[model samples]
Structure formats: C-alpha cells, structure tokens
Target: MGNRVFVVGVGMTKFEKPGAREWDYPDMAREAGTKALEDAGIDYRQVEQAYVGYVYGESTSGQRAVYELGLTGIPIVNVNNNCSTGSTALYLATQAVKSGQADCTLALGFEKMQAGSLGTIYDDREQPMMRHLLALAELQEFAMPPAPYMFGAAGKEHMERYGTTEEQFAKIGVKNHKHSLNNPYAQFQDEYTLEEILASKRIYGPLTKLQCSPTSDGSGAVIVASEAFVDKHGLADQAVEIVGQAMVTDMESTFADRSAISLVGADMTRVAARKVYEQAGISATDVDVIELHDCFSTNELLTYEALGLCPEGDGGKLVDAGATTYGGQWVVNPSGGLISKGHPLGATGLAQCSELTWQLRGTADARQVSAAATTSGVALQHNIGLGGAVVVTAYRPANR
Candidate 1:
C-alpha cells in the first residue's frame, strides 16, 4: 500500500422500496454518490474511479450510475461478492488509492434488494461454479436431498447443543427492533419481546420471522483518498484513515457444521482481527464500538465468540450482561443492524462503514453514544458470504 488511504466523505440513502431493481438502484446510487461528494466538499468530477457494490444488480451498474450522474470520464467497475459486495468495493477503492492508481476514489454500495429477491452477487464468468457452491452448501447443511430449510437444521442443532433458549435469541430481536425505532432510515421498526419473537412464524428451524433481516432498497458510499492527496487538498483534518482492514473467505458453507457457536469467529474472524490488530496496533479491548453482521440472531451469538468478546460457548453471556447494548462495553449494532435496519445486501457493507464513521465522528444525534469518552472509536464491520464467506473490516477516525 502507498502510504495510507483516508475516507473523507460518506453517504447513505434511507432504506425503502419504490424503485426498479436496475434503474431505480442507479437513481438511489446517484443520490448517495452526490451526498458523499457533497459531504467531502469535493466536486463529483474529482472522483477518479468508481467501484459499485451490488449483490444482485446487473452488469456495469457502476458505469450506468456514472453515466447518469454525468461522470462518464472515469472508470466505473461493478463488483458482486454476495453479501460482502459493499465491502469488496471499499477494499478495491482503498487499493486504488493505496496503489497510487487514483488519489481519490469512490466506493459505493447501492441496490434494490426487493427487486432482486433472490439474494446473490452473480458473475456470469463463474455463475455455474457459484451456483454449485451455494447448492452444495444447501446440500451439506441437510442430509435429505434438496431440503427447503438448510439453515434451519443447523439453528435447531445449535439450540440443542448450547442449551440456547428461544428467549435468548428473541432478546436479540427485541434489542435490534428497539434500536431501529430510533433509526429514521431503518426499514423495520416496532417493539417485540422474546415471546413475540418466538411466537412469530418460523422461517427456518429455530429461526423465526423476527430473526431474519428484511430486504431493503438503499445506498451507501464513501470517498477514500491517499494521505498525500488529503494533505494536498487540505482535507487531512477531516479525513478518517483506513487504519486496518482484514477480509477473508471460507470455502465451506455455514450450514455444514452448526456445532461451533463461534463459526468463522474462531477461524476466519480471529485471524482477520489479529491481522488488523497488528496493523492498527490495537486489541479487542481498544475497540469502542462494533457494527456486526447480524443477519440472524444466532449469528451475533456466534460473533461474540468469534470476535473474542467472550469465552467460547459463552456468547450468550455477553448479551445477557448487556455488553452488546449501546451503553455496554463495545456497543454492537448501534444502528439496529441488518434485522432492524434492513439488509440491502449490496448497500449493507458500506452502510455499516457509514454508521461507524458517523459514530466515530460523534455525529449521530439521537442514537449517539454519549459519555463514552472515546473519539478514537474502533469500528468493525462483518459481511457474511451466502454459506460462509465472511469478511471483516476495521476503522478508526483519522481526524480525531
């Protein structure tokens, strides 16, 4: 990497469902892109390259937006990496700056998830392989051929093994929904208790309707510039540097083995976190807030283990103690996460980054964490693969 990359601007559109999948996504994307540019106080023309993140958007979606936004001079690349598509765009944009290919780059995550109901980041080059991989994941998770509920069986087995109560999982639903109540941009907002969550219709095994993230239509964007560029532009005082980032992918699907509560937390997350720790010169204790990938209640339970927030098989303890809550140690999903905030696969990753940046900058008004006494907030984002492709990214405020 060349010196370092800094994020100077961020933008996110309110999650909604009113636009066409392909065309409407671009409109929302342009709105988000303009917001990011304005937030940085830089002209849209300054954006040298654009990397668009979308799990289900059509090909060259980035270019389409650029053309619509009247910025066709630069290269716009489309990225499709399943749920981690947004982060993949961030990673690529960071590289563009770090590699000196561009001083200022645009990293955008925009999608009409409801338009593309079947969630995925498809690449025709290897669609068969990806499909085969996902199908195999479904197969591995179920013994019966072509079972409808691949994740359900694992959820049930996890409850049986860990003695995890339905209430425990429902508490997660309650917390996120409560948090979402304060989020104006969130898609789902209502009050529900553990009993309500349990009483809700079952989507899979132990997973109920309340436990899953809603399909969202939204956009997230950030502008990353090199240290030299920030200094030259007199933007060093306002930029947030990419202190450390670690992204990894697992070949196995999540359903294969539900015995491990930590899942990738122990293997992938630990390794990735350790790498970022070495790079950022910090530990889990130093992190002030974490915006995790909470697509399901059980995922967060396992994350507490994988992220080293608690001992093995004791992730539930962290929740019970309120460690994952806003006022607790290292608040988790202060933005209400995917379940409450809505999970537009493409936009979710950058949305996490945007929320992290705002919290670190202390710009979150009503939902802000007060008295934390930490401007040096450590932000963590988790983006999971369809089966088990998990990518972890961490950040710190550069201006602070």
Candidate 2:
C-alpha cells in the first residue's frame, strides 16, 4: 500500500420498492452524494476523482449523476459489474487513494429498477450469464426466472449433500426480516415467523418470495481519503481505515467442479475472502459484524461457509446454532442484508459499505450491533455478482 486509505464519511437513501418513490437516478445520487459530503465535512470540489455505478442507464449516466453534486470536471468512470457494480466502484475509489493516485475520491452507486424478476436487456446478442447457465444446466434442468433457480439449485445441492433442511434456509429469511425491523432504510421492515417465510409463495426449490430480495430504488455514497487528508480535515476521530480489500473473479474451479455451489461464484467469494483476511493479518474469527450479499436466503447460507465462518457443508449447522445473529459469535447482516434490505444492484455494495461504516463508528442507531458483541471492532463485507465478481473488504477504526 502506498498511502493508507480511510473512509471518512458514508450515506445512503432509504431503499424503497421500485416506483414506490417518485425519483430518478439523478435525484437519488444527489441525495446520497450530498449526505456523504456533509458527513465528511468537505465540499464536492475537494474530491479529485469519482467512480459512479448504475446498471440500467445511458452511457454517460455517471457524469450526469455527479453533475448533481458539482461541475468540477473531475474524472468520472461509470461502472457496471452486474450485482457487484456498487463495490466495484468502491474498489476503484479505494485503489485510487491506496496507490497515491489521489488524496480524496468518491464512490457512488444508484439504481432505478422495474418491479419484478430481472431479465436480459439485449436478446439480439450473447447474454453475459449464458456460460454459467450452461454450466448449471449440465446438473439440473433450467427453470424460469434465472436468479432464483440458480441460487435455489445451490440450496438443493446443499440439502442433498449435507442434509440441510428447508427449515434451516427459511430461518435466514426470518432472521433478516426481523433484523430489518430496526433498519429505517430497509425496504421491507416487517418481521415474519419461520412459518411465514416457509409459507410464502415458492419461487424455486426450497425458496419462497419472502426469501428473495425485492427490486429496489436507492443510492449510497462513500467518501474515501488518504491519511494526510483525514488529519488535515480533522476527521481522524471518525475515519474508518480500509485495512484489507480484495476483488476476485471466476476461477477455473468455478466451472470444473460442476457443483451448484461453485456455479454461483462461491469459489470467487472464498478466494476473495481469503485474500482479504491475509491482507489484514487476521482470521475469520477476528471479525465482529458483517454485511454480505444475501440476494437470496440460500445465498446467505452458502456465503457463511464461503467466508470461512464455518466449515464446508456446516453452514446449516451454523444457522441452526444462531452463530451469525446478534448475541452470537458474529452479527451477520445487521442491516437485514439484501433479502430484506432490498437489492438495487448498483447500490447494494455501497449500502453494505455505508452500514459497516456506521457500525464501526457506533452510529448505526437501532440497527447498531452491541458494543460488547463487537469486541474485535473489525467489520467484514462480502459482495458478489453472478457474472463472476466478488469484493471482500475489512474495515476498522483508523486509530486502531
């Protein structure tokens, strides 16, 4: 690392269902970006560069989004890496500061999506997920609405291979929905019993409507600055250091294994998590809070093992023991995760970043993890996209 990078500020808009709020991408960006700048106690002019992320927008949408903040002519790069778009932008911003390219940079992500399941935008050309779909088809029949079928099959594999039950998976939906009850920004704050989760309309194998993330419209922003900038701006007290971060793409094993678990980028998540832990000079046991990509309840269970929170095939046991919830070993998805918090693809990762930042700063309000429970003061984040990209990040107070 060249210069230590710190997240000086973070902000996000309330995640709402698609069309529930009358706002466009620009409006979302303006709200989140302005709040972040204010939180950092800096002006937009102070940002030397920016990386904006959005999935369903025109080519210059990034420039248009940032124009809502200022017209400084700063370099603006638009990013779209499927579901991981938000963190990909964040990864670039952190690299800019870490490599000494710029003292300060901004990472912003927003999305305005249509309600319902996601589908391919262009039918005339090759779909990005065709290869993964083909790989999955080799094991089981392809089902309608690719997202649920893909993750749901992985859940089925877990059930067959490890004796994981449908009730174990339903527990994740229940926990996340209950967790969302405290998060004012979450799209779905209503709590549900495990019976309620299991009884919801089934979308795929062992997966129900309540277990899947809903389409959402929202934006999130994070301001990253160098150590020097933090001291100069008197932000050291609140700065959260980016101690370790790594991004990994699909590995050969992703396809070679022919397992539904690996087919959904579990290997990518494992590799990325290992790299982040190695970089931070810590182990999985050292982490306190986590905000992972739980686009589906099944994905959340798979991630528990992928992130080394438990041994392979023991994720169900971990869930059964309640090791991942509050009053347990680590509080995973304190923000309700994607399943309940909402999944606006472009903004998901930034929302994770914002939540973890607030947790480390002890400012998450009702959703705050108990200070005693977060004794390690280390927060871990995992965000992955299906076309094959995963970003794992570790954060702690700068003074630590």
Candidate 3:
C-alpha cells in the first residue's frame, strides 16, 4: 500500500422494484450521494475525483449524477462492468486515495432497471457478454433467461458432483430472507420458510423466484479518504480502512473447462478472493462478516468454495452446519444480500460496501454480526460480473 485509505462514510437508498417508486436514476443518485457527503461531514467541493458506475445509462451519467452534489470541476469517470460495476467504481476510488493522487474520492453507483428480468438493450452494438454467452451455449441450453440457466446449470453440476440437495440451496434463501426482516433498507423483508422457498415458482434448475435477485432501482455511495485526510478531519472513530482489494477477469479455464461452474466465473471469484487474502495477510477464517455476490442462490453456494469459506464441494454441508449465518462461524449477508436487498445492477456492490462499513463500525444494530457484536470486526466483500469479472475486498475499523 502506498498511502493508507479509509472510507469515512457510506449511504444508500432503500432499493425498490423497478418503477415501484417515483424516482429516476438521477434522483436516486442525488439522495444516496448527498447522504454520503453529509455522513462524511464534508461538502462536494472537497471531493477531488469521482467514479460512478452504471450499465443502463448514456454517456456522462457519472458527471450528471455528481452534478447533483455540486458543479465542482472534479474529474468524474463513468464505469460499466456488468454486475461488478459498483465495486469497480469503488476499486478505482480506493486506488485514487491509496496512490496519493487524491485525498478525497467518491465511489457512486445507481441503476434504474425496467420491469422483469434483465435483457439486452443495445442489440445493434456488440454485446459485451457475447463470448460468455457462447461459452454458456457450449453447455446444455435452457429456454430461460441466460443468467438463470447459466447459474442453474452450475447448481445442477454441484448437486451431481457433491450430492448437494435442492433443499440445501433453498435454505440459503430462507436464511437470507430471515436476515432481511431486520434490515430497513432491504427490498424484501418478509421471511419465508425453507419449504416456502422451495415451493416458490421455479426460475431455473433449483432456483426459485425468491432465490433470484429482482431488477431494482437504487443508488449507493462511499466516501474514501487518505489516512492523513481522515486524521486531519478527526474521523477516526467512524473510519473504516480498506485493507486489500483485487479484481480479476475470466481465465482460459472459464471456457476451456466446459464446466458451468467455471463459465459462470467461479474461477474468477476464486482467483480475485485469493489475491485479496494474500495481500491483506489474512485468510477466510479471519473474516467476521461477508457480503459476497449472491445474484442467485446457486452462485452463493458456488462462491463459498471459491472464497475458501469451506472445502471444495462442501458448501451444502457448511450451510447444513449453520456456519454462514448469525451466531455461526461467520455472518454472511446480514444486510439480506442481493437475494433480499435487491440488485440494482450498479448499486449492489457499493451497497455491500456500505453494509460492511456499518458492521465494522458496530452500528449495524439488529443485523450486527456476532464478531462485531462481541469481538473484533473484520469484513470481506466479493462482487462479480459474469462477462466476466470479480472483485474481492477486505475492510476493518480504522480504530482497530
């Protein structure tokens, strides 16, 4: 690390179904961005650079969103990387601070999706995911959304290989739904029984409607500053340091293996997570809280092995042993995760960063992880975009 960087504040709007609220993307961005600035006790003029993430927007949307904060002449970069867009923005912001290029930087992400599952918007242009789709096509095809089919096939393979059951996957939905009940910002607060989760209308393979993330409209932002900036501003008590982060793209294994698990970018997640662990000088066991990408329930279980949370092919047994929920070995998705918190394309990753920051600050209240509630607090975040990229980050309280 060149210069230590810390997140002094974070904020996000409560996610809602597309068109469920009367707000536009700019409106969401304003609300979330202003809140983060206020939380940091700074004005927009203090921000020297900004990275805004989104997928379904036109050019300069990042500049437009930051204009809501102030018409400061800051450099605003627009980023798009599928589901990992938000974390990509956050990664850039952290780098700006750590490289001593900027004292204060903002990472913002928002999306306003249309109703229903995601679909192609620009058929005329080259699709970024075309190759990933082709790789997916090499496997058994299904008459469903590409996302569900890709991840579902992975789940099917995991079941075939490791004896994982449908119920085992459904249990993740149950646990996350239950966790969402206590999160005010979650899109779905109503808890569901494991039976109900299993009984819900199936989307693909073993995944039900409850297990898949819905299209959502929302925004999330974080304010990162150098340690010198944090201390100068007397923000130590509320600061959270980003210890390590890494981003990786799909390797030849992603397509060469002809495995749905690899095609869906599990290998990318594994590689990025491993790099972050090594850079942070810590292991998965040291993490007290996690906010891994759970765009679908199958991906969550697939990620457990990739992130080294459990032995390969042991994710089902890990859940059965209750090692990934409150009062367990680690509290995963205490903010309800994308399964309940909603996936607003761009906002998802920064929202995860916000949740982990709150956890590290011991301010998550009812959803507080056991480690934060009683002992040292450490957080690990994993975000992925299937065309394909993965970002893994580690965080801890600055005062620690």
Candidate 4:
C-alpha cells in the first residue's frame, strides 16, 4: 500500500421497510453524510472525491445526493454493483487514500426501494441475472420468487451433501432476529423462537419468511482519509483502519459445477475472503467480530465455511455449537445481519462498514462484542450480490 487508509468517520440511518418511510433518497443521504462529516470533525470541502452507490436510482443520482453535502466541485463517481454497491464505493474511497490520490474521500450509499419481493425492473431487455438463472435452472425447478429459491436451493444442497438440518438454518434466523433486538438501526428488532421461525410462511426450499432479508430503504456513509490526514485532524483515537479488502466476481465453477451454493456466489465469497485475510496478515481466528452478508439465513451458514470460520460442510456444526454468537469462537453479525438489519442494496455494504467501525471503537453500546471476545481488536465484513459480486473487508482500530 502506498499509504495507510483510515475510516475516520461513519454514519447511517435506521433501516426501514420500503414504504415505511416517506422520505426520499436525498434525505437519507443528507442524514447519513452529515453525521459522518460531523463525526470526522471536517467540512465537506475537505473531501477531494466521492463515490456514491445505489441500485434502483437513475443516472446522476450520486451527484444529486452529494449536493446535499456541498458543491465542492470535487470529482464524484456513481457506482452500481448490485448488493455490494455500498462496499464498492467504500473500496474505491479506500483506494483513493491508499494510492495517495486523495487525502480524504467520501463513500456514500443509499437506496429508496419499492416494497415486496424484488422483481426485474427492466423487463424489455436482457436481464443481468440471466446467466445465474440458467445455472440455477440446471439444478432445480424455478420458484416464483427467485431470491429465496436461489439461496434456498443452496441450503438444500448443503443439507443433502453435509447432513445440515433445516433446524440449523432456522437457528440462524433466530440468532439474527435476537441480535437485532439490541440494534436500534435494525429494521426488525423483535426476537423469535426457532419454532416460530420454522413455522413462519415458507418461501422456498428450507427458508421461511422470517429467514429472508426484507427490502429496505436507508443510507450509510464513511469518510476515508490517509494516515497523515488522520494525524493532522487529531482523529487517531476514533479512526478505524481498512487493513485489507478484496472484491471478487463469479468464477467458472459458479456455472460449470452446477452446484446451487456456487451459483449463489459461495466461491466468490471464499476467494475474496482468502485474499482479504492474506492482505491483513491474519487468519479467521483473529477476527473478533463479523458482519457478513446474511441476505438469507442459508447464506450465513454457507458463508461460515467460505470465510474459513470452519471447514466446509461443518457450518452446521459451528451453528449448533453456538460458535458464531456472543461468548463463542466469534461474535458474528452483532449488527443483526441483513436478515434482521435490513438489506437496502446499495446501503448494505456501507452499513456494514459503519457497524464494524463502531465495533472496533467499542462504541456499539448494548451490541458491542464483549471485551473478552474482542481482545484481537479486529473486525471483518462480507457483502455480496447475485449476478454477482462479493466484497470482503477487514478493519481494526487505527490507534492499535
């Protein structure tokens, strides 16, 4: 790295159901971006560049959103990478600081989504997910709502191949919903029993409605700066360094293996995670907290193996052992994950960044990973989107 990159500030709005809030994207962006700037104790003019992420917005929305912050005449790039859009923006901002191209930059993500299961918005053209859809078609019949079917099939395959039980999957839903009870920013904060989760409306395969991530409206922002800038601003105490990050797209096995898990981007997550660990000079065991993509409960189980948290096919065992929750091997998704925290597409990844930063700073209040568990002082984040991309990131307190 040419220069160390630090996240000096972070902020986000409470995730809400698609139509639950009357505000528009600009309002979301302003709230989050303003908070970040205030946290950094810097003015918007200090930002040399910006990368804004969104999935369901029109072109130039990035410029429109940032206008609420300032008209600094800085370069602004709009980014769209499905569900990983938020992290993609953060990745770019990190690069800008690491490459010494900018002393300070802003990564912002926001989404104003429509309610209900996500459907193709552009029906007249070739859909972007056609290839992934074809791969899934080779394995099983298509379900009416595609997301549940896709990830649910992956869970089904894991069960058949590894003897993972449906109860194990439901347990993930229970764990995340319970975790959300402590997160004010989470969309769903109520706790549920494993039986209640299993008995909820079945969407596809082994998945229940409670196990799925709801469409959400929210925004998150991070201010990234070079180490020199952090020192100059006297923000070392609050800064979190971006130690390692990698983004991977679908590999050949995603299509050729005819495995639903691979088709759902497990390999991508594994590859990206491996690269991140190498860059950070640490193993999975070194991570104190995690906020992985749990867009579906099944994906969380699948990701445990992909992230090297456990051996392949042992994800169910890890879950049963309670290895991923508080007082376990690691505290994963203390932010309630997507299943409970809400998945606002573009905002999801940056929201993960915000949570992890708070975690490293020991400012997460009720949901903070315990001091005993956080001795390592490292946090990991995973965010993915089908059609498909995955971004894995590692963070630690800058003062460390």
Report model 2's TM-score to 2 decimal places: 0.99
Rank the candidate models, highest TM-score first: 2, 4, 3, 1
Q: What residue pairs are clashing in model 3?
A: none
Kindly report the root-mean-square deviation of model 3 from the true structure over all alpha carbons.
Answer: 1.1
lDDT of 4: 0.93
User: How much RMSD separates candidate 4 from the native structure?
Assistant: 1.1
lDDT of 2 by residue, 141-201 (tens): 9998999999999999999999999999999999999999999999999999999999999
Per-residue CA lDDT of model 1 for 300-385, tens digit only, reads 77677777788766776677888888778877888889888988888888888888777777787766765322556677777765
- Per-residue CA lDDT of model 3 for 153-183, tens digit only, reads 8999999989999999999999888999999
Name model 1 segments beyond 4 Å from true: 18-23, 115-151, 251-266, 371-373
TM-score of 3: 0.98
Kindly give the number of clashing pairs for every candidate.
Answer: 3, 0, 0, 0
- Ten contiguous residues minimizing lDDT sum, candidate 3: 368-377
C-alpha local distance difference test of each model: 0.73, 0.93, 0.91, 0.93
Candidates sorted by lDDT, best first? 2, 4, 3, 1
